[model samples]
Target: MKADPKNVLVGSHYLDGNHACAEGAIAAGCKFFGGYPITPSTEIAERVSRRFPLVGGVFVQMEDELASMGAILGAAWGGVKSMTCTSGPGFSLMMENFGLGIMLETPCVLVNVQRGGPSTGLPTLPGQADMMQARWGSHGDYEVIALAPDSPQESFELVIHAFNLSEKYRMPVLVMTDECVGHMTEKVIIPPAEEIELVERNYTDKKPGEAWPYEDTKNLLSPLLPVGKGYKFHVTGLTHDQRGYPIINDEAQEWNVRRLIDKVTKNVDDIVWLEEKDVEGAEIVVMAYGITSRVVQPAIAKAKKDGIKIGMIKMVTVWPFPEKRVKELADKVKALIMVEMNYGQVFLEMDRCVAGKCQTYFVGHAGGTVHNPEDVYKTIKEAVK
Candidate 1:
């Protein structure tokens, strides 16, 4: 479906990643937003607060991050495409409810504009440290789709992809953008509303009493019915049967949890998005994502000029890990280098996937700022040697 013309800012404009993300949400038919303001990510909420009302959407600044997440989940179930944005401390507060969204198979978007942190660390600085947390923050077993945008333009494009993926997979999707990308300004060209495609929620056709909300379908996706639509459905975070009713048993546990994981895992090829370059006969492959991907381009160019055949994989989808592609590259490349603003969170995953097929190295920064290009260049030189 094309986006609503009234909601699209269809022209060239200089935008920061936060504002670009807001425009992306509006263009993707997201009509409801609930978020608590936090440094680095507050601009997204602020932008949405001003823009949503003009497009017949709603923006609610909740009392806390917990309520923010909860409200979005409710809004999603209430037949609105919903989202929330936050930074580190607030991201931590939203975890349990994030899990609830997953358990109930609610489709929504969560944007974490990452900052340096264990607590209230660097509010205004950039960090990619939350890469692992996006995968494992919520308790229990389930899958999530997360995209990392390297620039304001990508921040605009990828959040729409995030929402589309969320609706397609029937799970909470995450945009794991960092403070640098969120704050950096760049030109973003929003295409005409007719050019923008959106995925609408697939509603169940069965009447209220005739259908189960969580009924397993051939596509591994269940249709959702809006509340007050005469759908007699129960939604809960507990282990439940296909009927969405609690069922406490080993069989029920395996049935419910396994599907949650497999929904994305089994459909990984469709969910995984990566931009690869120069892979054929390359001795070294530089794997990076988000802000780090942009920062490493100069280093990669330098490596090539110095006669090192270095390939690059810019991860667009951060979660679902792209293990198969990593393994394929591991077999061909002599060494793999993972770069990021965090201290080797995704690097560890790369190493795990490589599994002794080739040498794996991590180019990590502690994350108040981006890595120095020279340092990354030196690492690439070292890897080639």
Candidate 2:
């Protein structure tokens, strides 16, 4: 499917990441937005609110983040592409319902413009600390898909990708951007509508009485039946059967949760996105994502200039972490260096994937500002020793 011509901007413009995210959602056929104003992410909501009316879409500002999450879930089930935006505290508040979306197999997008935080640590500052939380913050055993964008242009492009993944897999997807990228202004080219591809919702073609909302399938994905389409089905956050009714027992629990996980785990290769540069025969490799991916460039250049053989891996999809590829690199490289604004969230994943196959080093801090390029260069030098 392609984007609606009415929704696309169709030209180049200087846009901040948040505003670009709003345009991306619009162009991707998102028709409902539910969000509350929060620092570093409010521009997304503000832009959506102003533009939605013109595009015949709906925008609702709910009481809080929890309500915002619920609203988008409802909208998604009503047969519309929906989304919401927030920062760290709001992201934390939405976890329970986020799990609900996962359980009910709701397709929606959630944008978390990450800010420094354990709790409201720095509302206006950038942080990649939420990378771990996006995977595990929601309770129970389920898999998630998350994308991290480094620049405003990517912020525009990746939100569309997030929605496509959510619809394709029938689950909530996340755009884990940060304040630095959210507020950074850059030139973004909005392509023509017919050139922008999208994945339409997988609505069922079965007769009303023949389809169960959670019916078991060979591929493990049940096609969605929109509400008020003469489809009488139930949905809840509990363990459920093929009919979408509560089936509170160990068997039901295993059956229900396992598929939720397997759908993503079994299809990791199709969903995960990574960018590798000059990794072959390199002695050291630097791993980073979000704004930190761009921040580490100077260090990579310096290391290359000094005759150090260093490569780079920029994670485009952060969740369903690129374990296979990282493991492959671990066996080839002499050492791995993980750099981010957070103390060591994703670095832990890298260390585990390396599994002592090679040396692993972490260069990070509790987020306030980005890393100093010289500091990253020094770490690269040390790792090569």
Best candidate (score: lDDT) = 2
Question: Residue 383 in candidate 1 has what lDDT?
Answer: 84
Q: What is the Å distance of residue 270 in model 1 from its true position?
A: 0.2
What lDDT is obtained when candidate 2 is compared to the true structure? Answer: 0.94
Off by over 4 Å in 1: none
Model 1's TM-score against the true structure = 0.99
Give the alpha carbon lDDT tens digit for every residue of 1-385 in model 1: 8788998999999999999999999999999999998999999999999988779899999999999999999999999999999999999999999999999999999999999987999999999999888999989988888999999999999999989998999999999999999999999999999998999888888887888888898777998877897776898899998999999999999999998998999999999999999988889998899999999999999888988888899999989999999999888989999999888798888899999999998899789999999998988888877
Q: Please provide, for model 2 over 1-385, each residue's C-alpha lDDT reduced to its tens digit, 9 standing for 90 to 100.
A: 9999999999999999999999999999899999999998999999999999989899999999999999999999999999999999999999999999999999999999999998989999999999899999998999999999999999999999999999989999999999999999999999999999999899899999999998788777789988998888899898999899999999999999998998899889999999999998899999999999999999999999999999999999989999999999989999999998888988999999999999999999898788899999999999887
Q: What TM-score does each of the candidates earn?
A: 0.99, 0.99
The per-candidate count of clashes, in order, stands at 0, 0
- What value of lDDT does candidate 1 attain over all alpha carbons? 0.92
Q: How much is 371 displaced in model 2, in angstroms?
A: 1.0
